[model samples]
Target: MSDSNTTDFTNPSTFILLGIPGLEAVHVWISIPFSVIYAIAVLGNLTILFIVKLEPSLHEPMYYFLCMLAITDLVLSTSTLPKILSIFWFNSREIDFNACLTQVYFIQCFAAIESGILAAMALDRYVAICHPLRHSTILTKPLVAKIGLAVLLRNGIVVMPYPFLLMRWSYCRTNIIPEPYCVHIAVVKLACSDTRVNSYYGLFVLFFVLGLDVIFIAISYMQILRAIFILPTKDARLKTFLTCGSHLCAIVIFYIPSVIYSLIYRFGQNFPQHVHVLLGNMHFLLPPMLNPIIYGMKTKQIRGRLLGLVTR
Candidate 1:
């Protein structure tokens, strides 16, 4: 509250998200593809949502998780793309500190939630294939509701605090964040205050939250594979593999780039800033846009229902 302690926070407190770092000359051109991707991600995910909700057969656990995933993807893309496109198309890069913090929070929240949903879906498949008799009883509607709530709460409890922690830091620098969007560490690094706690807790969440989700998903697959290999019939094994293919694809698309991006942000001190920025952008963009398409193609019931809706 005192003028002595408060440095001038308004001069450049507004961050200029220098999208793509050095590629500012033709941001409009860049906006074209990003615009297209954002549009598809939103509309495609929404379509998946609508179909899942309206169809009675999709009221089951797997489809419910799919709906959850679709909703997460929609929010994840919505949280960042508007500002990013604004920067790209209109050169409107000025963002309020609190607003940027809000963006970072929701973006991180939905991203963590998505990873959680994927882990749940893997478990759903595990129940379905590995324990066929118990699958329905185990993943009932009530249990699905609980799982969804747990994912929401788990992510909210973990990720929502980081932005507040970020807000506590004194940011007296150029206020120009180098990434295309307001990433957590990228924004935190600009603060004049010591960010050791932020950095340390970030690693904690990375390993404890997101990293644990990835590990559990891998473990679920290992169990699912083990179960499949021991099945009595070749046809049964092949069917089980097909059932899980969409999930495997979704996991690979999301986590591979995500892990690389996180590792580079934390450890690749010598890597170029633009490389970090680009990988971060792709981590959010590609998976959301492609996930719905993967399900529509791979799952017969979804594909058939999607086609029926499309024909109408």
Candidate 2:
């Protein structure tokens, strides 16, 4: 249990991730369900990405966002599921500190990218529906590229500190992460040294980065609603609302669970770890799996074109 008692890091060159402690007894049983979900998640996202790439007509802004979403989902799910499945099937959950941090880094990056993409998509909807006359001029290809680059840079800077802070902390003592994967906060929490800085940074991210993005999304939707009501033609209003409906649903499904999990983990106590694990998997999987469906089902042009391409 002490720092010196555990095997030396230099010799072993790996640390065991004591995954889902109480449930380790049922690793085999867990594998059955976990494998199924993992397979479906990866396959589902890949299909979306394939359809987006093959369909030439989906080269526009909206489908581009959907493609990006699929890519992000694949990264996000890959970050954790392989390790999780290892624990389930092979009973091997060892992950070196460096590897663990690397996983966390990528997960944070993709999640941040997805958030930025959501905001961009929301803005796209606002323009397409509310500012119909000027939508084309506003969301030009160059502008979209600029927005994507900005999002990547912003998230990179924010998540860059996490791994550095983690490296500074000596975790020779207890290496068992409570959850299945190497979550940023969860990994930091296990450190023997003081984690005040990590906690502070985590708070900053929760409130400032994720919090601000959600707020902006909400405001954008509000403006969208106001614009919708003012449209004189009933058919036009319905069509406009339908266009944004799928995205709106995806946003709620994605953001609400994230916000709720952050709040529950930070403030709420006496909650079960299993609940956290389940929610974490959902958070990683749901957005990617649903995003393609949302965009494909809602967008008439993309759907029709994709179907045509498939048939031809």
Candidate 3:
């Protein structure tokens, strides 16, 4: 076969990633900071998981969901960090097609799972605050376990079509992806064939995964708030609100940036390049770091358990 025919038979099997724009000049050096942050994110989430598991007192539904959230954070950070480090530190921006697809799949899965976990946490708060008499009956051990499994399965199914769709495309010539990690949109942009199908699927998944999850969480909190206002005693109202404060903060941090990002990318056609990378990292990194901090700071029980485990 001729050179053109040989090349035509198969799509390009590798891609180059153009990381953070201005920082490209110092990619190797910039990676040092990212490496430290990634290490902290991983270690922090793992610590929370360990603390939740070791504390027999934390065997409640709330802590169980917290542990699940920690696990999801680990997955999210792991999905993007190593590849980012490779691109920045080692100048190894070339990713095999399978590896890229694997990264995209895991990133989507982790993100979707995180959303579902957050919604579950909100529901737990709702029941504990709004229906204290029935909290135990509603959020039983088996029920929490089932919800956790459902989160994983739902996210897996939602993201399953992403990698499959990617595999069908032909990369004619474009191979450079303008992002730090193998984001789904960036991957689809390289495909030579029409990507309307993939784009529509992504939109549908985003609406269901992030939009539906956020709406459900908000509705759960709204009910909790309504119940809180009806409490006859001022102290009772204060206590319930205090108990939910950390979760409220976490939900805001996790979802606001995501919503803002979607809006900007959709409307701001010429948004700065740095903004995309920054928002991407923030959405992935901040929630994991803040979640543990929020729980540790707001909940005395978690702090006491962590201190006891450390001193022992």
RMSD (CA, Å), candidate 1 to true, equals: 3.5
| Deviation of model 3 at 48, angstroms | 1.2
Worst 10 residues of 1 by lDDT: 1-10
Write the number of the candidate with greater lDDT, choosing between 1 and 2: 1
Writing each residue's lDDT as its tens digit, candidate 1 over 1-312 gives 221323566334467778887777878888898999999998889988888888888888999999999999988998889989988888787787788888889988898899999999999999998898998899999999999999999989999789889878877755767877888878887788889999888888888778899889889989998999998999989987999899999999999999788788779989887778878899999988999989988889888998887799
Q: Which predicted model would earn the best TM-score? A: 1
Clashing pairs in 2: none
Ranking by TM-score: 1, 3, 2
* Model 3: lDDT to the true structure: 0.84
Residues forming the 10-long window of minimal summed lDDT in candidate 2 = 2-11
lDDT per residue (tens digit) for residues 59-127 in model 3? 899999999988888888888888888878777777777888999998889988988998999999999
CA displacement after TM-score superposition, residue 7 of candidate 2 (Å)? 8.0
TM-score of 2: 0.89
The clash count for each model shown is 0, 0, 0
lDDT of each: 0.86, 0.77, 0.84
Model 3 TM-score (2 dp):
0.93
